[model samples]
Target: MRSSFARSGLLTAGLCAAVALSTPALAQDKIKVGLILTLSGPAAALGQQARAAFEMALKDLGGKLGGREVELVVADDELKPDVAVTKVKGLIDRDKVDVVVGPTFSNILGAIAKPVTDAKVFLISPNAGPSPLAGKGCSPFFFATSYQNDQVHQVSGKVAQSRGYKTLYLLAPNYQAGKDAIAGVKRDYKGQIVEESYVPLNTLDFQSELAKIAAAKPDAVFTFMPGGMGVNLIKQYKQAGLADRIPLLSSFTVDESTLPAQGDAALGMFAGSNWAPDLDNPQNKAFVAAYVAQQKAVPATYAFQAYDAALLLDGALKATGGKTDDKEALRAAFLKADFTSLRGAFKFSRNGFPVQDFYLTKVGKRPDGKLETQIVEKVFSDYVDSYLPECSIK
Candidate 1:
């Protein structure tokens, strides 16, 4: 009888140990996230910041999600929607990723939103937030830490409108975001647009375009060209002396990453940026210090937003105990105001967009060894896009 009782106790111990072992393995398998970003091409420099933020987040969080170590798969979308779509499909069908992180461009965002959502996967857009996605057209599975495409430009337009800048010329790359930007500026600013030009993406030489702008003689020129194109345009604009005759106002296209390349040419130019390299807040300072320390590179708003998105996801994972496989649970956690990000604290609205800040920043050399985006004007402090009514989701 004593031997039998001892055997029974041993059996109970074995069963309990087996269950405990299985629990961790099961939790670890619950979350798998895939990253899609422009790791190359003209936007490659911008991608560097996003990549850095992601790596830091993983390291800081000990590679865990929801009490389980996250299984992360990263792919370079190369700024091509087709490439982005292929990578996303592979991640879902082959890798069985539970959630998809991003595709930076708004055009690319629009292309991939349906596929991931249709597959019952959440597509967390860290950067792209087009007006269409923010409006009655919004999707339940599509969430953005990034501000709406128009919100920043709307602020720019409002600034222009307030200043009574009547004669303006608009330039953008021939793409969805560019078109959306043009429309956004037009939405608020009632002014004489001398001409609207759509240049090819990544066109470095703008001598001819500058000549036309100089000839038209608009009071101001508003442009939407990101990455290399922004660098090239601003450089040539200075060379052509357009910066003296007409103040160049742009949005998102000329922040920290491109400003360094622009050098003295970017000085005194006004840009509508969500964050600057020299923001006074503790959150911005820490993020800038950490990024430069880790990657030996300055980060852009693109990187900042991406970093914010990861931090947001980390908070959600913890709230859900790493059980990201439950779509409803994960979504609820994301919606729950549990995140504390480098941008301070932010949360998604019912429609999956941010109530954030938009500032009109000026490019200038501060005392620091970096190009600074000084807040010359603020468009909105606690801003939510007016088009949130367009979102299909509650």
Candidate 2:
């Protein structure tokens, strides 16, 4: 009887050990995603739109991607590159996330790209695709869901040329993206630049720049100010009485994100984008309806791009059977870009940036008394970034 009792106790102990060992394996199956964005300060709206759309997409997917539960960790970069690196490192080393998304501005992308990709974890940018990344610095693990920094600006430049603008004045915030913006405008614009002025990033007051524009008296003005900066510029430009005289042509300067504050001042303003709320397509119509219903605000390019990023991840994970252990397999899956884009007809260029269409969009008041960007015309079809040839990724 004693031997039988001892054998039963041993068997029970072994069963408990097996259960303990299995628990960790089950936990490991969950997909951890870290979202890093500039969620504070003047540019907060951009990041907020991205975060909201990404969350909305995940919820639409039933809180899972590729049939596996997701653990999402969100961090605010506060528009600081140093802060972004610290938070992203924590997400990588401490949280052990499978992927990292965001940092809405180009400067932050420049800061965190190396650390995240060097660790063999994928980094996807919904916005802020800097030129260096699209060129010689391209990495197998970094993919940009948004257009390269210069592509949208290139669209605006083409618009300026088509509109018969002879002498143009250029303005942008001083940053890597600002430099890229100027370069893109120059690429397609064959006009004489009266003045090329760059203000410090996030500078709200544009009085001095306005005076310069007034003095130069260029036929049209092109700028790339975004977020709160855009809000202030549009208002100040109208206040300075330059709206009617010097037409404002830009990208990211007067869009859905800043239109609420700009109000009627942004009416008839032309901007360049890959997608707009009024884009006529089944996927875009559905997305716009859902976003308007839930968010109660017009969706911006930031929102659409971020939502596309989620779809990209879902498709890649589904292809890999929800496995992230093999980095090369995951990279290959991402390169496939098997998901439908809100912008319609999106495929990854060899350098991991999008090869997609661009449009000339104009801000207009909706029938429902809301301001939104409406598509004017297709600017570029299947537009590949010029830097693609410089990238050795092939």
Candidate 3:
């Protein structure tokens, strides 16, 4: 007996083919794009924001790319790797999508990599940029719109070292991505690490960890916690009266998405990211204004990256004359990186990871006292991923 997922895939594939066949008169040539995101879990906000921005991008493109109509299909991975793999398979087999935009978490991306690559589907990640993919295991079809997992953290570490912090306490979830983040920190942070704590994923209570941090008495603290974990951690740190004493430095933790919920607790924290809401450029200014008009909230790194991915797709489609079936043409077009990115200067490394500036962002209160992220400094200028040399892609 076939598994339920297998049966569902067959049904969906048949249905999709039938729709295409039956509506031949209505079938204008189109580009089918599938987005797989964690849309129903603790990290749902990330996907929600990405979806919102991508929709705006579609609108900006007049709902068309390369003179072809767009067929957009979205799926919720529910933050489960198994679910993500099934969804990827369905998108390729059932939906006949031309491109797969995301599976936001690294684990899910890792799970679906082989299947998507095997299918020769272009998988452009807007958020997750795992180390393995950047190095020896690089896939020609895989491109990261976001920085590598370690690159942003590595910038934060370099900044910390420049600031002369002598000792640090590191906190992150116990996962491959989290471990990679810590390694990035250690690579650049010259200070001695007083303590390293790996919390279970989605563990809400940071009280135990906070107690340990306080006892360790490190000069500064670093973390890569994102989503709800950031809110809980920052709030608890403030409540424990350590907010002022030990500076909180992070990557992807204290952003516009997390700062509003954290309020003043997140204020003064430093974070490293490729784009900030207030980047000074016409493209960025336009994106920020449009995003604010749509989302009614300041855009975060996730939103910027997703919007950039849409633009990248548009450029590629234009170059390919909307011929998504010509995979080689699309791949070559994507490698050109011709779009105006939200980040001022953007390009991909030989490994397909991003080579771009990383900004040091600070959480601050607007004149109206609402929280926002400001670009405090540029932590890394046109930096390339360290894993590129390990990649054998010619």
Candidate 4:
């Protein structure tokens, strides 16, 4: 009887040990997040800043979401759409990321939208919300933490019109975003366009465009060149001795990422966006402080958006209790837009694009004699995209 009782006690102890060993395996189930950014080439600065902020978000969130670990996978798109597509596919198939963030440029976003949506992977863009994605191509599984393509340009138009500029020369890259920028400016600026030029993508020479601007003799020049394009154009503009004579207004042309390289040339330049690094808000303050402490650099709009994207994903993960398989539930949770956004009072449009404030920022000298872009004024309060009418999302 004693031997039988001892065997029963041993078997019970073994069962308890088995359950204890299996519990950790259940706890080890993590939600995978895939981040695809243009981590190389001319846009490397934007991607690097984005990566920093995302890592910051992970750190702030204690590297977990809803008591579950989050596995983050990052990839570089090399500013190539084909490369972006392949990397996104690999993220979905191999990395098995439940959420996908970024491919900063609009061109890459366009290339990957179909595949990302078809795969039903939750795509939240840190930047690059092209018009089609915000309109006819709106997907339930996709959301944009950034504004629509034309948003900042529209704000620039408002700033230009407010400044009493009767005529403006507009320049942008020869791409979809370039066209959208021109269209956006026209929508807000009821002035004569003396000249409009779409320079070739990645064009280094702005002399020809500058000369044309000199001849057209517009009161001001508005441009939408981003990344290295903006750096090159701004330097040439300064070199041509046009910086002081003609005011430069832009969309994403002058920003934190490009401003240091621009030096004093960027000072006094006007650009517009939904976010600025010096925005006065609790969330913005916290994000900026953390970012500066970690990266030893000022955060840009791109960085803010990337950080917000991570927070947005975290909110959804929390809402669904970290279950990534129920995509519909996750999508619904994200649509609720429950996260604390750096862009104050943020919400999504019918098409999943951000409906938020737009501000005019002036590149000015900080107390430390460093060039920085600060918010001059708010242009649009809770602005909705013009393409929303085309979107049929209920």
Off by over 4 Å in 1: 1-30
TM-score of each: 0.91, 0.97, 0.92, 0.93
Q: Each model's C-alpha lDDT?
A: 0.81, 0.93, 0.86, 0.87
Best by TM-score: 2
Using lDDT as the measure, the top candidate is 2
User: Could you give candidate 4's per-residue lDDT for residues 1-394 as a string of tens digits?
Assistant: 5698899999999999999999966755887888999998886898988888888888888998665788889999998889999999999988877778997889989988888889988888998878888888888988999888988899878888988999999999998889989989998899899988898877878999999988888899999988888988999999998998899899778898988788877778999888997899998988887877777778898899999998898888889887877877887889888889987898887688888888889998766565678998888998899988988888
Against the true structure, candidate 1 reaches a TM-score of 0.91
Clashing pairs in 2: none
RMSD of 3: 8.1
Better of 1 and 2 by TM-score: 2
Span of 10 residues, lowest total lDDT, candidate 2 = 1-10
Question: How well does candidate 3 match the true structure in TM-score terms?
Answer: 0.92
Error of 3 at 4 (Å): 52
lDDT of 2 at 41: 96
- Candidate 4 achieves a global lDDT of 0.87
Better model by TM-score: candidate 3 vs candidate 4: 4
- Candidate number that wins on TM-score, 1 or 3: 3
Candidate 3 residues lying further than 4 Å off, grouped into runs, are 1-28
